[model samples]
Target: MLQRPQANEFDSYFTKYVYNVGDKNINQFLRDQEQNIVHLYNTLSEKEAEHRYAPGKWSAKETLGHINDSERIMSYWLLSVARGDQTDLPGYDQETYVNHGDFNKSEVAALIADFQRARQSTLSLLDSISPAAWVRTGVVVHKRVTARTILYIIAGHTEHHMNIIKHYGNRLT
Candidate 1:
């Protein structure tokens, strides 16, 4: 089982995501969360998916798109660090990515499919890491992070958005 990353393993900004994971088994938690999110999102109507909780906030579809994009980026970081890459990875603006994504224009089903595919890719990458590689460090957005911390971030990031999506669902009902 993969151990939880220490606070020093990641940037303080990501503490919420990491703590959101708590003591759950990382591998199983990722798998189960994917299934739960996919199943929940599958039930949304097009109109419901397009509803934004606030005027400036992301709609449900855009939120899922953001989740997919973040997982892919973090997975890449995980791979790079696990492979002993010493390069410093840059940060991305989620708002800019979401604006360009045009997720609101796509079918909600399509966004959900994208989420599943991205998650599967992340899982596959995680499966291939050697035990020693989990502790490998890399610079991301100027902060030093371990390969395992990236994994937790991916999971925590999803969890954070899942909570928002759930709130959206509540308001829709």
Candidate 2:
């Protein structure tokens, strides 16, 4: 069984995300989340996809795009770190990425398709690593992190966005 990574295994901020993930079987959790989130996105109309809960909040589509972007970045970090890369990974600006993503202009189908591909890529990388590789540590945005913690973070990050889509952004209806 894959254990929940220890607090010391990742940056403190990321731990909140890891805690949000329910399943300790990180690999399966990642696979499950991809389908679950796409299911939720499929329920939204284009207008609902564009809906923003409050002023300055991201639209539902943008939020999904952000989730996709985050997964890609985190998974890249995990792969690099697990492969024993000691280089300090750069921190990304979420706002900058989202602002430029143009997800609002794209069809929901496109967004979901892109996200699915990114997720599949991540899963492929994860599957290539051995159990020992899950414990490999490296620097990302100045924080010491392990592959195990990144998996939990990915699962939890998806949960976070799902919650917002389900509640905050027009109830995902």
Candidate 3:
């Protein structure tokens, strides 16, 4: 029963992600969202999986990879910050991550499978934390953030990309 994070607990830019969470239970959201992602991925054809809605856009596989990458990093941050680490974290370049993933030639199911596994690890990590640690804060890319905030971001970021996947995946011909 994690309460929503306060506006003052995180930087303004992250508000959209947190706001996207609304009043839902964060842990339950994470668990259900995992199933949603898997279902979406399971519905895509191999050709659809490699689709890019327009020029210069990422393929569905790449987008899925990006979500996986983000979850892994943010979950690590959640772990690091919750444990009272004060280390300043650097921001990741999404484009670089997408380019490096080479997901275009990989199986989308494999990517989605990886994401599910990583997400389970994240869920376990969050569940294992002390209740007080959820409020722990740390500096991330020069912005002060809490473990609770990152959890919201983790869920919201997936939602954001899943919207993209649905939009682009629909455009597949």
Candidate 2, residue 91: the lDDT equals: 80
lDDT of 1 by residue, 95-150 (tens): 99999999989998888888899999999998799999999999988989999999
Residue range 62-171, candidate 3, lDDT tens digits: 88899999999998888988999999987899999999888878787798889989999998898689999999999888899998998998999898888777776669
Estimated TM-score for each candidate: 0.97, 0.94, 0.96
Query: All candidates' lDDT scores?
Result: 0.91, 0.86, 0.89
Pairs in clash, predicted candidate 1: none
Cα-based lDDT at residue 17, candidate 3: 87
Off by over 4 Å in 3: none
* Order of the predicted models by lDDT, top scorer first: 1, 3, 2
lDDT of 2 by residue, 35-145 (tens): 888898898899889988878989989998998899899888888889999999998999999999998998998999999999999888877989999899999889898
Worst 10 residues of 2 by lDDT: 164-173
Flag the better candidate by lDDT, 2 or 3.
Answer: 3
TM-score of candidate 1 on Cα atoms, chains taken together = 0.97
Model 1: lDDT equals: 0.91
